[model samples]
Target: MSEENTPTSKSTDINERHRVRMERKKEIVDDKIQQAQRKAGVIVITTGNGKGKSSSGFGMVIRAMGNDMKVGVVQFIKGAMSTGEEKFLHRFPDEVSIHAMGEGYTWNTQNRERDMEKAEAAWAKSKEYLSDPSIGLVLLDELNIALKYHYLDVHKVIADLQARPPMQHVVITGRGALPELIAVADTVTEMQEVKHAFKSGIGAQAGVEW
Candidate 1:
């Protein structure tokens, strides 16, 4: 067999090329990381028409708790149904304070006034948490939806978020995040749903959709 076609030779060459490429990539990544010297609390917004928005926020809450950081969670537009995250996080009462404040989706509640009231109440609680420097991470889950529906004032929310403690991270998750909020966010992620099991007639199941 030709030397170039030999299996061992080809494998060795490929491995060497991959190693060189990875080394170069690592150097570039390290330089970028080193250049990022400024450290402070970040505002992360997860919004779009897809799954895992709130799940991502909860995951961060768990991470913060694991690091012994105090976290506060205010869930908007999800009180009608009990979720696995709520149940699980509620167990850590000392580390995490969770509030699920929503009568349900707009369709289910069919009362804009009541929805506004709940959203306002939830925001009131969230403001308290935001002002608390002891809380390292504050997750305003589904607050975007409340803003989208005009239940809460986006300007006021932005002002409060901007005025939060310098080292307190905040995460807001929901669909249809406003442009003004996105503009002020430090990190913004938009989830896109290519295909969902619900479309295939598969209902939400425990430990997954909840």
Candidate 2:
């Protein structure tokens, strides 16, 4: 074969091009990182039809705890059943405060008035955490579901969230997050349902789905 068209030469050329591309990408990423000098806390929203929204929020709770920060969690529509995150985070009484206030899902409860009452109670607890500067991060788990059902007023929630401590972060998780919440959030992640194991024959497993 000719030297110009050799397989080894082509491989080397491709590798060199990849290296150059990655180097440029690294520089751009590094520049962005350096340019981000703001130290204020952020609002993060995890929503959509897929699962893992509350899981992601709890992961941040653990992350914040790892940094020696206090966290408060209010589970809006999950008090009927215990969860792994709740069980685990409850172990840290000083670092974490968890309130699972909901009676259950709306369908199971079948009472709008009761659901609204529970939601209001949960919101009151969440607001306490939001106002506390000592609480570094607040997780409003499954709050979007309550908002979607109109158990709580979206505008009031948004206004209270806006008034939270400047350096206290917040995470709201559930399917169908409101556009108003998304607009004000610094980070918004939507977990789209591509496929689910439960749709097959598998049931909700321990540690994974709980």
Candidate 3:
């Protein structure tokens, strides 16, 4: 072949190799995508003494909803009062179902009986959502704290959740997560407090906290 033809042939060979490599990469990606679609969802547990546990769970809810999955969230320690999460997530009322315990935190309530009652009510509602197959993701916000504070029966909660529909996803968040809860969870994340401004006497800013 002539010099010009030789260069053209080499360029064509390179292009062909690049095209084949891209095609193989695409097939690999397609196979992984199919695998993800076929596998069932699993439980997620987020627990720690640091802040934003619920926030992280809710962020996952948003991701699930974006994929057209139905999500339910039950706030045990956080009451019916307003928060930034409620404000934004409220926009997707149909896609998201949120049930807030009427009674707030233990210290906030200062009434053990009332707190227990509210936690029980919230647990009942959470149980109902957990059993529903249509609920692709369930966020049990502050559930660990409820268990730690003896606001709800931990065994009962575990039993009910253990009987949840297959393929359903559950996320429990709060400090002092129980061992049983951790055992059944497929993914557990502990948000350690490495350094936080709260220890420096800094008040929680709006939108960041609450």
Global Cα RMSD, each model: 0.8, 1.4, 5.9
Weakest 10 consecutive residues of candidate 2 by summed lDDT: 98-107
Clashes of each: 0, 0, 0
How do the residues 103-161 of candidate 3 rate in per-residue lDDT, one tens digit apiece? 65677768888888888888889988988999999999889989998878778888888
Which pairs of residues clash in candidate 3, taking residues 3 or more apart in a chain or in different chains? none
> Predictions ranked by lDDT, top down?
1, 2, 3
Return the top candidate by lDDT. 1
Q: Report the number of the highest-TM-score candidate.
A: 1
Tens digits of per-residue lDDT, candidate 2, 28-125, equal 99999999989988999999999889899999998999999999999998878788888888789999998997587888999999999999999999
* TM agreement with the true structure for every prediction: 0.98, 0.94, 0.80
Candidate 2: misplaced stretches above 4 Å? 4-8
Error of model 3, residue 94, in angstroms: 0.9
How many Å off is the CA of 61 in candidate 3?
0.8
Against the reference, the lDDT scores of all candidates come to 0.93, 0.93, 0.86
TM-score for candidate 1? 0.98
